[model samples]
Target: MTIDTSDGTPAASPDRPATPKTTPKKTLRPRNRKAQIITVAREQFGRSGYHNVSMEGIASAVGITAGALYRHFPNKQELLAQAMLDGSSSILAILDEVDRTDSKVVFTALVRYGLDNNFRSLLFDQEARNLTPERRTEARAGVREVTSRVAAALRHERPDLSVPDSVVLGWALTSIAFSPARHRTTLPRKRFEALLARLFDVVRTAPALPEEPAAQPQPTSNFSHTSRRESLMGAAITLFDQRGYRSVTMDDIGSAAGVPSSSIYTHFGSKAEVLQAILARGNETLRLGLVQALRNADSREDAIARVVHSYTNSVISPDSAIAILIEETANLPEEAQASTHIAQREYIDEWVHLLGNETADARATVLATISMINDLTRVRLESRQCAIEDLAVRILATQTV
Candidate 1:
């Protein structure tokens, strides 16, 4: 016989009551959690700019408390730096995987990779400047490396083109590939890729423009004490374009406008307000110009040419504020961002109408064509007016495959 247990007959408890079996609570390991945090942070930082995204926001996105987020990243800056590094690393890996000897092959690979990893492209373009100087330099080096490789490949394939032309073309093609990142467009992946490849071929075969002195932007007579508010807006746009929205301070804007820092509050409540005003003015400018172009045109083709000329001229004009408006709108406050986007949508819709594109895919193709025109401004080409109009006509006439 067995001896009885001394503790309340627990040895025979199975006969009295059965203990229920429980599953173990699943938990993410530290490495997996860290990876999750980076991925979520990248998406958040890409969607909303670095200044707009908070540590708490990222932590919430990762389904973790802020304290836990600190355990992984010492601060938001570190998180941003790491996110940029991760993106650059991934992009460089893709570049390495491609056959870099063939310009067309490299471009197709990069376009596909950029489209597939659109968020990463957005992060690099929009938020990379938020990093510290040292970190920014590091991120920039990776970009330059990609550009250099592409330029090298172009040199190999297009022996007829000069070194500088090949380099600029490389940059332009990259810009075209990354255009989808800036706009919200839905298309079948295969179709979009094919369209992008066709676009690349068009740009590749297009004759290179001779590098000429860019026309000096005429001095604006609008920036006087009587136009202090306009002066400040102009100053802010320049600063924002040069240093980015997040990097600029109110005092900086004030100083640039030759006004005391305290005086800025008289015109705008906050920095975001200043940005909103700038964007509103830019939207109004473009809208008015487009309306005028439409009124003056004898035909749809003429309207398109006039619109393209108006846009490119505005971009090069000293007082034109569209660059900052296009690039920094994401840094605006939520309400302002919404309104600005609505304005942008109206602009694009007008283009779609002009293009006679009724379907969603056609609308996307129209936007891409517009993007190609915009990208041309990045290179130093002579006769910008004629170049822009010719390109616009060609792009509009070309059917998306």
Candidate 2:
């Protein structure tokens, strides 16, 4: 008589005394698979944004089944929360190890840490908003701690700067470091690090702007849009900016615009189409403004100033749609996202071309400078335009240095 083995092969005949069959061993996952999952999830979330990536997609990217992914993370929120927690913890640990007395030392360490873990920095900036309230609080607390530490370091180094200025400078340096996480570049790592260090020095030594009056709320016009399509577009941009694109629905938008939910389709095919239109319009406006600014300039410096002024004005206005363009672009449909990105690249390339730095390092520097100005917009400077323009000039000076 023959006995079947677990592998479905018949065992050796008993007459041969059948050397004992060896049972096949099941493959074991790496002990740190959970950590691995979080790492992969960070890259996915950072690249695709939180709303665009799915649990199954993450699992596939990690070479695991959806069931296995669940075995590690109960749901997407838990995974995102864990990723943010891990990233924040890592950044804090790096900050702790660096000497905080010297602003340069702290800033250099931050730039290195940020570049080495660019994906993690992107997670903190872009995906942290998707976490649950509790997790979001935890992440924000950690970031605030790091920011406070940097601010203290800035104060220690520059006793002349006011408390507010020091805090703003600290945030500025942090934004400079995180800038690389937002774009792609081919500059060598060491070269990029050196450029960032120089940029930090420029920011550190720059003269402070005079304080201005508090920001006054700009008056709004009472006139209403006669076109339903225009009204819907306006309402959608506002809602998309306030609540992320994923959270806003057609019905919600219709109510906000006073259009029937069923009629929204008559104007636009879907919510994604609405976003596409918004992005296209914003891109065109920026492109046209920049071209006009460049055309009217007499010299390289004049052109740079004009471009920076125009770009800053467009982004800083209360009614500016640039925020939606920046934050929600990743949530767009693939084809629309590609088109927007192409347009943005052309825009950046124009800046780099105009900067007269067509090399990879120069391109990277230009992008970083733009990023610094863009990020400073969020700081609520008293003299917003003057501060931005001064900082832009200072940032541009670093490329020559």
Candidate 3:
């Protein structure tokens, strides 16, 4: 809605009105051409990915000649790079705000930003391939900013850890979170969150950092077991979520977990075990969240609210494990698959239980309703977030009622 003169210039922001010292009195008032080009490029890049969009295409969209565009940007790469940076400005803003917070906050912020901001994800996943070499490194530097933020948070949260300890663990957290945006578009939101919760539980832990003596036996009875399991699942989720089932090997999981290539067997019998654990924990986490949300529900409306809010919060929140579980369930062993199924069934049964015995006879109808609820919620998470409340209401009316 705001633009500077047709001459290329940055727009005025009340936040940074033209300052006497900052602006020169005679500079032709640096036009909004750069901003205008960025806006048009965003539309073009988003509609057709980087590969499909051309310099001429963007120039045409901006109502300028390709030669005129070169006046602002030396080449298409510079334009693409600038547009990518512009596209991710919101993410940078979020990262800026969270940079001062704890590791828990950083993990939460990264996941929240990735899921809620589709444009951010688009630019994030596309920039490496789309931007020029000079700018690609810059884009990666922004990505590493998240890693640094995570590391700093980890350092403060776990004071006993050394510098290396923080760096390595921060990498783990970033890997777990960074995968979904790069892939997992068709995945359910609740599922995504359960994985995050599971992953957060992972990044929030350390197996007694390398700074500690190898002979020292770390404390076991506290949150160690629970945290390690989630950590393993987090690593597994990243791998399975990124590389499909047939392609991911036990070695891949081990490498992802930062364990010795042969050490994965020390915990689980096979890669199947890894899959099972990730999917099982994912479903269990989701089931418990849904169960807890509906424990006091007395009306269909309340039931719907509790379910939608609970699942949506998890989906929207940084700790999304549910999406990871459902998306990767097929990768698990046969026995693990059963646990995953039971966990999912229990989530729906909890919803059904909230509806009471009256709907018991409507098992088929309830099943259909459950599917609708899941589908609508997932759709809300994936594409149209603005209308999530309306979507949830319609879902409740159709199914819970």
Identify the leading candidate in terms of lDDT.
Answer: 2
- Models 1 onward score TM values of 0.80, 0.86, 0.39
**Candidate 1 lDDT, 1-401, residue by residue in tens:** 99965644444365667445578999855768977888888877777777878999899888889999999999998998888777667767888887888878877777777777674442235456567889878876776676677788877877888876666666666666776765788777888787777767766766764445577897879644667788789899888877788889999999999878778899998998899998998999889889998999998778878877777777776777787776788877788889999998998888778867566666766676666555556334424546455655566655523
Q: List all candidate RMSDs to the true structure.
A: 4.8, 4.0, 18.5
What is the number of backbone collisions in each predicted candidate, taken in the order shown? 0, 0, 24
Cα TM-score of candidate 3: 0.39
Pairs that clash in candidate 2: none
Candidate 3 displacement at residue 149 in angstroms:
42
Error of 3 at 90 (Å): 38
Query: How many angstroms is residue 286 displaced in model 3 relative to the true structure, after the best TM-score fit?
Result: 1.9
Which parts of model 1 have CA positions greater than 4 angstroms off? 1-35, 120-124, 210-225, 242-252, 261-265, 292-302, 330-335, 369-393
Q: Is candidate 2 or candidate 3 better by lDDT?
A: 2
Candidate 3: stretches off by over 4 Å: 1-228, 296-299, 316-319, 356-386
lDDT of each: 0.74, 0.79, 0.58
